[model samples]
Target: MPRRPSGINDLDLAIYGHIAEGGELTLSEISRLSGRSKGVIFRHLRKLSALGVIEVREVGGVLLASPSRSPRRVIAMGIMRAAEYPYVLGILRGLRDIYGPVRVLVYEDAWREAQDLLSGRIQLAMVPALTALVANRLGGGRVQIIGGGSGGGMGVVRGTGGSGHAVVRTSNTELCAERLGLDGPRSYFGGPGDILGALVSGKVHEGVLWEPYLSMASASGLRVEQCEIEHCCLLSANSGVADQYGKISRIAAAAISSARSADLQAYAKLVDLPVQLVESSVRGYSFHEAPDVAYLERMLDAARRALLPGSSVRDAVVA
Candidate 1:
């Protein structure tokens, strides 16, 4: 299943890029450039036009799209829906309440989110702490950890001690395997959905997963155990938009607290999971409005010990 789409997506951006390259682009030109059908180009242009990021006009009976301002997409990717719930509430609802409608993209993993974020295609992204660090290094002082990340919520479900066939592995998930000395070969999973799929497909019996995925694993008759590594995910922003970090973090935190008390059906739908799973998954984790200085330092130390590639601490984090 795909994540919910509330704004511009990669395909839309590709179409927009064709227009931004200068001169008005006809539907056929954009479709050919983007490898999408004319109807698909038309559909995406509507939203871009409505958002004032592009202007669609009929010129001499041929419809054309012209670029205005480049679109900005705030992405929230997590191991499960619960992890992104606050950002969805805060950025989607709170941003509208304060600023206006903004594009928000949900993801289940950090791979593409990290790529888009570092390439400036993304305005902001909430991803694993390790990913943010590596991205900051890759972007060369162009990216920074803005705020609003999570701690804890990492564990193993039916994890075998160093000798099993395989266990689910992700950036944050592997922390537990490393901490608990699980030395077995790892089967990498993209996100919560992938982990679930692996379980259902019998590809792996154990998974090192986070919150909601762990809960789902438990519900599937697997035993769960908490890992002591407290580093999970963090919020990273393009340095060009550094000024908005404070406001984004504040709104996200408030929205997180607010959503905790509200009905979780919306979040469930966004993550495409049952409301019960969403509710239970969040119970075991802690969400922060700002960076946790002490834990972050500790995680950085661990990263250094693990010989991970990262920028200096000062450049990576806002703290």
Candidate 2:
């Protein structure tokens, strides 16, 4: 069995797994599979279904249960406008359960998040891991990664007519494209929307982006090769906030770190994309409570070759 996340118990997880494996089962079937009494199973089923953590269907006068969607509560939490991160929805849902009423702050891009973090306009922000790294450096190392978010949501697309030209936005993505040997005069955009729009307009041969932009590009008949990139996004806290609100930071970290793929898939509808696209995009992403040093090292090496001025990944990482 997978390790139990905070708040949920081992039995809840077992029941979830059983229902998931069985596709859809009645209370009695789940009880038998779980080796629990029908009444006990029925109670848990009702609770889970009501929470939207599982789907309950009525057919032939019998209730069918399946681990379908996870529960998401509307609550206040602060977040950026970068909707490409699949785990962002999951984390917000999780954080809402903890903090109540997540208040979202939409910035033009991750760079804006970094600026807000430095100016005390935001207490907590989730941006690209590289963005957080650079922000920490810019802020004299006053920000720290309290947890990780989705990674590998970015991709490089070849233009419609198979041109070698390309465009980029994020630093990490630019590095990934360079590492992939996509040689061409690169046009730079400040945001993913511009890059995608340019790609659609035949202005650029290749565009680097994160999903659902990448998925959108592919759906529009453009070829999207998933960047073999990792650690794309991370949750960072201002050092002062982390120091004074450590418990809240931990809660937020635990919530995000515990996000499962099913949570990401369920969130697809919220983002108005096909579940398969969200599913496909996230297969390349990994969520964790801590940064992957190896992946960061690889990314940093690539960043350096692409003319990024970071001395070392370690210099940007929080202890």
Candidate 3:
């Protein structure tokens, strides 16, 4: 039996993009512009209209579609391993409480978030502080740090025999390994989400991952060789949205300053881990509103050593 379509598809996205690029488009116009058959286009348009992502109107017996205004204004918040970091999760929860159901874009690397931030694809991003610096340099210093979250959560773990065959997650971890002399074993690079699985599956004998993952792995019987590094994650915004700083800062403060133990149980559920593990993970990080210049420079130096191209750390930080 042919299954009924349930939600948005590429056809729907293309049609919406076409309409969003200009004035309202008729069904035929959307089909022609998007290069899809009329019947397929109609199905997608009907779905999008039903979902309220696009508007459908009739004029002169022709059905016309237009992009909804709300989606365009939606600020895209980018993150990785959101459930692991309390402050990152707090910022997200806080923003949604203020703005209501904002869109989130998940990426494996801060590098990708930096690219999207520069291209205006994401209005706000929660990235590694250095990644924000790299993007700031890329944007000619247009990136602004409204605040920061999740301090001191980085660490490295090794498998049996203490061989550091590792896949480090962030550039920060890479730097930590180099600084602390944990870089001896052959190392590969993976995103935070993949690091734990990689280690458990024996793809790598050692792994460097951040909170919740660190706790979860230890709970699952993997030995944690070391977890003592303390790097922060930053809340970054495009300079164009600087006027909204007052609101952003307020939301950040409310979330980070008011963090309570009860919050861990809820966050643990998101990552499908034990409340105890989540509680322990929270101890790995410090939540705060601002970061010092020297600390940011250390991160930038690491980013530079890790060879993140373009813009020295000095040029990247906003005054």
List RMSD in Å for every model shown: 8.2, 13.5, 9.3
Off by over 4 Å in 3: 1-66, 69-72, 82-84, 87-101, 161-170, 184-186, 265-277, 298-303, 308-319
Please, what is the TM-score per model?
0.70, 0.61, 0.66
Candidate 3 lDDT: 0.64
Write candidate 2's Cα lDDT for 44-97 as tens digits. 777666555678888998978975564442222234333345556655555544
Q: Write the per-residue lDDT of candidate 1 for residues 1-319, one digit (tens) a residue.
A: 0222466455765565567665688888888888888998899989878766678989788998886544433232222344434445455555443333344556666656777777766667667776677777877977687666666777777732323323332355555555565544455666766766666566676667776777777777777878765546666777766666687777667665564565577667666777776677766766676777677667665555333222235445896
Badly placed stretches (over 4 Å) of model 1 are 1-51, 59-84, 96-100, 159-170, 199-202, 229-231, 304-319
lDDT of 2 at 22: 76
Better of 1 and 2 by TM-score: 1
* Per-model lDDT: 0.62, 0.64, 0.64
Predicted structure 3, TM vs. truth = 0.66
Clashing pairs in 1: 162-183
